[model samples]
Target: MSLFQLQFIHRHRIVRLDDVPPQRTLLEVLREDLQACDAKEGCNEGDCGACTVVIGEPRDDGIHYKAINGCIRMAHSVHGMAIWTAQDLTQADGTPHPVQAALRDHHATQCGFCTPGFAMSLFALYQNKVCPQQAITPETAQHYLSGNLCRCTGYRPLVDAACSLNDSPVVTPDDVTLRTQLSKIEPRGLSNDNPYLQPHTLAQLLHLRRIYPQAQLIAGGTDVGLWVTKQHKQWLRIIDVTQVRELQNIDTQTTHVRIGAAVTLEQAWATLACERPELKRFWHRFAGLPVRNSGTLGGNIANGSPIGDSMPLLIALHADVVLAREEAGQVVERTMPLEHLYTGYRQNCLLQGEVLAYIDVPRPSANEWLRVYKISKRQEDDISAVCLAIQLKRDAQGVVLDASIGVGGVAATPVRAHQTQACLQGFAWDEARVKVAQQQLQQEFTPVSDMRASASYRSQVLVNLLQRAWYESQDMRCITLETLA
Candidate 1:
């Protein structure tokens, strides 16, 4: 147990490494040590799909396959899981798997570098269809495939392959043995000579944080992984919170949803979208599937990125964040509005040794209307130039009783538009009142000019989005630029 065992299935067999470096990415391990070069590293960040790989872990029903970016994922993160790569898709007789066959029959490759990533993504989609007995439509295939990019401009054939993958059912080999092996690797603490600590429980995590206050806490490594690969920052101590069972729970009550700090964006969005179907677009646009699968809501909020989409939506929903720390051998928790968590750019109110524990989001009331709008350069898998979320409650006569508006990418931190909210509240829900509120929104903050958008443009877009929300609230068809063009 002291050897820092890294256990996972590769090539249909259990692969264990006991001496892995603390920050080695899965792509590096795959190409360097194992010589499994199918998962290529194109961007070295999580943007490109060339490093896509499917991770399978035991769930209540069966194995759950998730496609993730290998380049930004720590090699040790996949412990007690099964990893499926492009090379593992072939049959024992050396014939191409159905996904590969569909791609081959459809001519889905040009440079052949991105094919492996595309194939693995398609494999996940195919498995997703079979496990849930869901049909794969062209739109579904396209939505799942957004994370991957084809520099050769070869996407039509790949989309065709995805849509036709259902023509042949995917038959996975019996993984009963694999599940048994994974089950035996009980959740024990792991630490290497480099002071990389993986604690299994909340108490252990808080104790470790108190002991090593300087140790960087990592959830999914979606952001911290960049510190190693992109920024080249070497850390002496690291505390990985992904294995903490208490931090991964999702509790839904009668009036609210309590999401653990370590809950992935994919899981949080899934639960939230179930209650609010309008979040489907924002969820998909949050990031590509791989990044969402690896990134956490807590990490996003704690990172304090102004353009981070989750903060605005959560703030608009009047979410509360639970911050915890160890004091005198007992865990102390404090809850506050999510908006108050941030103090400034890339800064938060978290004290030393303190950690974000949970996010509590209240369910929208019957008269409440919630809407989130993210305006980005690309339609998918891109950062928002301007993100806006508005939660408005009206009386039976259509008079606004209460309003909360959150705006991002226009300030040092994601902020609530108090001026705009005040203007909307107690006002009639009409075009004139919306116009006045739009003016208030534009004058509320002094947005900076960045590559994503100019200050004037961000302000204009923020006001325009408010207008769009008003139109939607009134059930009036508002023509968009796309519709006009």
Candidate 2:
């Protein structure tokens, strides 16, 4: 098959590139090639959202606009989509957009380095607002603006601007034109006989994996982007799976929710939160909006980071991961418990040429009670010092029928607290049983000390977290450190 030209709509015109490097990020292309410097490169990684841009694609309803970090997104991934930067929001006559005007009216700019990214993020939210809606609250604005950070401490005015957007007339995109333009550019399979290969289907992906077994598989490039920015290590070849339609599916089964490997964290959490509303708070803390918008659930699990918040929660829920590989001109699929998938620190059971296909999470039963807790230095957009997830079932007498406890950042990999779970099973749901389980949890793993917390502190926190879970399981109000003081 011949290599197809990378085509995308930028600033209302089609831009085509044939010789773009595979490793080139969208941020580099915007600043260096297109001279669209409004999307500033703050950290050169996805952490700082100064490189935020809104990408619109044709959906069933209309154009779906999403705010993503341009620093980690590959230049080729935007093919067949409409790319919008902060500069694109201005009218042809040079009038400021509604979001830009609102920010200016609310005095949301200081130093002005982060304003463009913030405006673009707000632009996406503004464009996608549902009809017959109430006014956007400050809390809602804060949630949407969480990804874009400003060093000048200018959040109050920015949040005010976000809330006041609804007061003005809603500006709708040219959906008919955008959808028509996007449909013209078919989803191209990109391969330049180079290391970067983006296959449009699962068959092509597995075939390419067989051809390039050593190529690094990247979904959203959230963690891989850090390697290039911080470690300065260049990957010889990269297979981007984000383009594979089969791996981007979210299927609702009668007994389980099957989430594709390439499904972004934002989409997976939205579906998961519907059945398990307890995870709503935990989902928000998974990362800032931009990271969640770009990062994939499968990428997070396959990275096998000990502190990865998703694994522990999934482990507690008894999720299974599906692994796939092409063999004898057919696809071979294998499903295993998510806990057993991880072997050690940043390690997994995936064999060479095999790829994670989907994560099958069982729907919560009516009797099941689930809770997840994350202890971090910062409340938003920070790695967990220690994360805990507990799933419990009780009988009519309040006797523990079953228990699953998963812990992270205190073990080589996210691990199930087998001893603690065993200790809690068949015990009465009372303070005495929780105390014994807490003791078992402390002795289950010898956590290493690091910058986040000391080994002793992690051990103690495990015990306290168990107690807190017990308090929460009952009707009693739990006292946290902040409230105690």
Candidate 3:
């Protein structure tokens, strides 16, 4: 079991980075070793699109593909997945992909550093859609490449490249060929004799956890990789859980939908979107497509950030988190509410030698109406200053029967406004009811002051969110009355 270098499955090619060091970005490996320097390092913190690349991860249904930042991604993070850089899309005869063709015809290149990233990101969009696709529209293109940033060229031409919407030559690489080349290399860990740990079963993971209790359990590196790159810290022993088949499952029964801890945010959102269309806005706003594709639901909950975007929805829906620990050579399970899992700021209740196994969200009733809103300084790719999730259940009389208000950025952890919900339980959907509930919420929370927003500002926005939720739930009509202060 290696701790650092990875044998990543890319397009079925086993890309073994045995000599690659831990904390080295994918951009570094591509440029230095592979000499495929198309993906450039812009803002090494993942803010720039110059290092954008599409990743194809194995899913229960099939393969899931999306774009991601290569500059900030750890080389070990691409294990058990397919990585498609801009260079990979070109034909053996040097013919470019359709996205590259469109970028050339449309004159999308300026400094050329960002072009490869843009091309790869757009190629992912092209792969996601149907073959012989229709011309991509401006709005659709913007949505696809929203994560990438272009500083040199004005974004007009680049946007046009994304809009071309033409399919590339139907070229799919043979995974067997890639894996065969990868198999010859030796597995290398991050620390001395601790390469990349790929676990095929729970027993192996438990055994490894006991041996390396301090090891970082990495499912998605979106949050953890930043600890190394931005914070500049090396995690010696890392257990890569991406290869475990059991942890990648999405099981749905009559009572609940159990999303495996390894399930990416994109997968969770896609599943939720199919069942509830109202969640589409939250899913898109959760993060950029690249981040959503790479970040996992379990990782988000386990990170235990007070302002984490995923916690409110899970809390509001009464989701449960399953924790697995090694006990007497057998894996033991303990389920806790998602809210209870977090203890304080960046703190969780997880024990040593324990890992989150799954997130269980109970099915909502037919009459249940659930909505989530994230209030941030910027609409997309920004952390929430005040996030709100409201789940309402109406009775026969159309009055509010049961309601749950789970909010982040207003407390130490993602918390429920129990008093506010109590205020609305038997109340009718009206201005007076909303007014009372709004007043109750003010008493329930004393939000911390931060650089993103002030305590007063967060409080005010939360009140507005409650009122707006009421307005939307009741009807399209809204009436305001002036009152003397």
* CA RMSD per model (angstroms): 1.9, 2.1, 4.5
The window of 10 residues in a row where model 1 has the poorest summed lDDT is: 186-195
The total of clashing pairs for model 2 equals: 0
104-191, model 3: which lDDT tens digit per residue?
A: 9888888777788788878887866634355667767877786777777468987776766554455544444544454554443334
> How much lDDT does candidate 2 score?
0.87
- Which prediction has more favorable lDDT, 2 or 3? 2
Cα displacement (Å) at residue 125, model 2: 0.5
In angstroms, how far off is 311's CA in candidate 1?
Answer: 0.6
Q: Compute each candidate's TM-score over C-alphas.
A: 0.96, 0.95, 0.89
State the lDDT of candidate 2 residue by residue for 1-485, as single tens digits: 23535688998888887777667788888898899999999987776689999988777888888899998887777878899999999988998888989998999999999998899889877886623355688767876787888999999999889888888766667789888887888666545465567798999999999888978888888888777666776667778899899999999999999999999999999999999998988898889888898899999999999999999999999999999999998999999999999877898888888999999999988889998999999887889999999999999898889999989999899999999999999989899989999889999999999999999999999998999999998878876543362
Runs of candidate 2 exceeding 4 Å displacement: 1-5, 130-135, 190-194, 479-485
Cα RMSD, model 3: 4.5
Count of clashing pairs, candidate 1: 0
What candidate 1 gets wrong by more than 4 Å, as runs, is 1-5, 184-194, 479-485
